[model samples]
Target: DTAVSQTPKYLVTQMGNDKSIKCEQNLGHDTMYWYKQDSKKFLKIMFSYNNKELIINETVPNRFSPKSPDKAHLNLHINSLELGDSAVYFCASSQDADSPLHFGNGTRLTVT
Candidate 1:
């Protein structure tokens, strides 16, 4: 069983459209995170949710938001998606910030 899973492995949408990626982890971790891998393959942390509360929010745009209904799930919602938003969004979880992260296969988002 996959410890972490994300829906819609591939997402293709036009610019200005809004879309969301759903993620879930069954590892019973205390922390969950959202990472974005740009076209250059640089990975950056977007958000971190721990114990049902948002903990770390990087310098991400206001258009990007992370919503967590529970500890096991963290969803990313992007509004007015731009061409710059086209990238692979990965969902990850770990016991703590210092712990190794287990990442989902990642959702490839393409904005044209």
Candidate 2:
């Protein structure tokens, strides 16, 4: 029962609106991350946090921010969402970079 989970499997939103995606993991992993898979299926890391400390922010827009209150929970908040932000957002966790990630099914965000 300890697996990564994200809310709203699909989101159809209007541009400029703000939205938040919540994620939780039950695994004992110390690191949690946010990745975006574009329409082309290319996955890119957006944020990474280890033990509630953010360690990486990969050139993501300022409007997109990730918050991890605890090792098992990380939430993403986007302000003034844009059309270019449309993609599948996946929540993942792993022991470390060398370890394989356990990914959530993903939140398909469509910004109209």
Candidate 3:
């Protein structure tokens, strides 16, 4: 049932607002992660969780928060969105960090 799902494949909003993206996976994997890609398509890790436990936490801003509701769900919450926040947010997972990560199609976040 969980094949890494994220809502709003595309988001368009002006600067200075709050937005949250939802994600869920049914792979029964232990680890889930969030990656952010800039306009040029460079990906960077944002957060990761294993079996509902926080694992990898990247150097993201306080305005950005990632929450894992369980081993099967990881959601991203952003506050006071800025123009720089515009990028692709991808939800990924694997058995562990050493394993290859499988990513969703991606949510294109466009903050104006």
Best by TM-score: 1
TM-score, per-candidate, Cα-based: 0.97, 0.96, 0.93
List model 1 lDDT by residue over 70-97, tens digit each.
9999999999999989999999999998
C-alpha lDDT of candidate 2 relative to the true structure: 0.94
Error of 3 at 110 (Å): 0.6
Candidate 2 local lDDT, 9-111, one digit each (tens): 9999999999999999988899999999999999999999999999999999899989888889999999999999999999999998789999999999999
What's the count of clashing pairs in each model shown?
0, 0, 1
Winner on TM-score between 1 and 3 is 1
Q: Any residue pairs clashing in model 1, and if so which? A: none
Clashes of 1: 0
Prediction 3 global C-alpha lDDT: 0.89
Which regions of candidate 1 deviate over 4 angstroms? none
- What does the lDDT read for residue 74 in candidate 3? 90
Model 2 alpha-carbon drift over 4 Å, by segment = none
Give the Cα lDDT of each candidate: 0.95, 0.94, 0.89
